[model samples]
Target: MAAKRLREAEESGEPGRRAGGGLLPFGLVDVDGPSMVPTLYHGDRVVVRYGARVRPGAVLLVRHPMRQDLLVVKRATELRSKGWWLLSDNQFLGNDSRDFGPVPPELVLGRVLARVRPSVSWLAPAGRLERLLCGWPLGRVPGLAARFGLSRRLSPLR
Candidate 1:
């Protein structure tokens, strides 16, 4: 399967190359938890761009430093001596850099461009509002949320 090949490539320290002799510059990753809350949610499918420039505030798909087989999505918080400090937008979620420390650059798989699945129409506006309020300063700025209507619908990628 593609996931198996990706894991193998990662473990081997090669860039996550696709099977069939072509480089995979992009990948689709499923969101599994509320760590990203307002920005992402359970079952949300994200488009991850491999080898993209990672910046503070950009969401990333990274291999767990201690458990490389596990991949997680988190926002890049800061550049640390080891690599990048990644944190969950939902502070209540404890399995981020706060617990595991900075993730080495090599473990970072890709930058999350946008959520693509579950379709925009399926996301309830009220649910988006609730998540925005719950996440507060980290998830959504109150003023921005009020003005923009708290929709997680991302623009289509060109």
Candidate 2:
């Protein structure tokens, strides 16, 4: 079967990634805002691990208390008295902990390990790429959610 071959390739440690395999030994997350800007983007893919240590500059995905279903990614700024005070890399962006207040460490799902950007070796110039590198907003999560649809929609049938 196709899956059998993919599993074999993974076991072989081939440079060619197998289907459903990741570049790192962690879950891959899609960046959703300009919070991490040049370091991360709206569409860039990032790897994260559940037990990764939290650091000042590390970007993280955390659950919103009021809306537990909604997950937001932001830079870990300071460990404030209340909780972790997260901030967006783009100072102009206002939809972060600075607006919502400190977030509990329990809310954090994982820490970003690395980022992967879209390759454009054979394509034309992209202004978005420039903005991404300049610490400005360039990617979003809505498009990713729409492209993949809700988790419920993607669930396999019995």
Candidate 3:
């Protein structure tokens, strides 16, 4: 049924679905870019709890500060006076707090609860281990430095 709903939403050309006018508290959004690669890929479907409690390390669906029409998925890396200091799992890619500065609280739409498309992954607030995994070269062809004989975590600073 959710798949059907997504398909209908796609046909209608909407970015995602906001559950029936307060009838439901969740919404569906598609992961649209490489900013969150490895952890989330393009076309991945996610379930977000609208107005859910926000926490550092939680993944959230946020409205772009400068471009309101764009919705972005990012990790709430820090809480500043303005709002969340968001960052991408793939630091090498995507626009994040480094680009737009802290996002206002109201622009945060929800916390991502799980991924439902392509696969099912409960998106609990990530911790150091999870963040470590995001930078680790695992289960990926490009991640393997087997040829070079010295594969290291993608990020040396971490």
Please report the TM-score between candidate 2 and the true structure.
0.56
Candidate 3 has what TM-score?
0.67
User: Each model's C-alpha lDDT?
Assistant: 0.63, 0.52, 0.66
lDDT (10s digit) by residue, model 3, range 44-125? 8888787888866677877789987567888787687888888777768658888888899998877887888898877753
Give one digit per residue, the lDDT tens place, for model 1 in 1-158. Answer: 01233454555554445421137687666678788776677877766778787765567888888877777888777787889887776667678887888889998877776667776421112444545554857464545542322333322111
Best by lDDT: 3
lDDT of 2 by residue, 1-158 (tens): 00122233345676755222555446655556565554455677655565467755556667664566566667676676777777665667676775788788887766654554552111111334423433423234333322211111211111
Name the 10 consecutive residues with the lowest summed lDDT in model 1: 149-158
**Highest TM-score model number:** 3
User: Per-prediction TM-score, please?
Assistant: 0.66, 0.56, 0.67
After TM-score superposition, the amount by which residue 106's alpha carbon in candidate 2 deviates from its true location, in angstroms, is: 0.6
Better of 1 and 2 by TM-score: 1
In model 1, where do residues sit more than 4 Å from their true spots?
1-16, 19-22, 120-158
Ranking by lDDT: 3, 1, 2
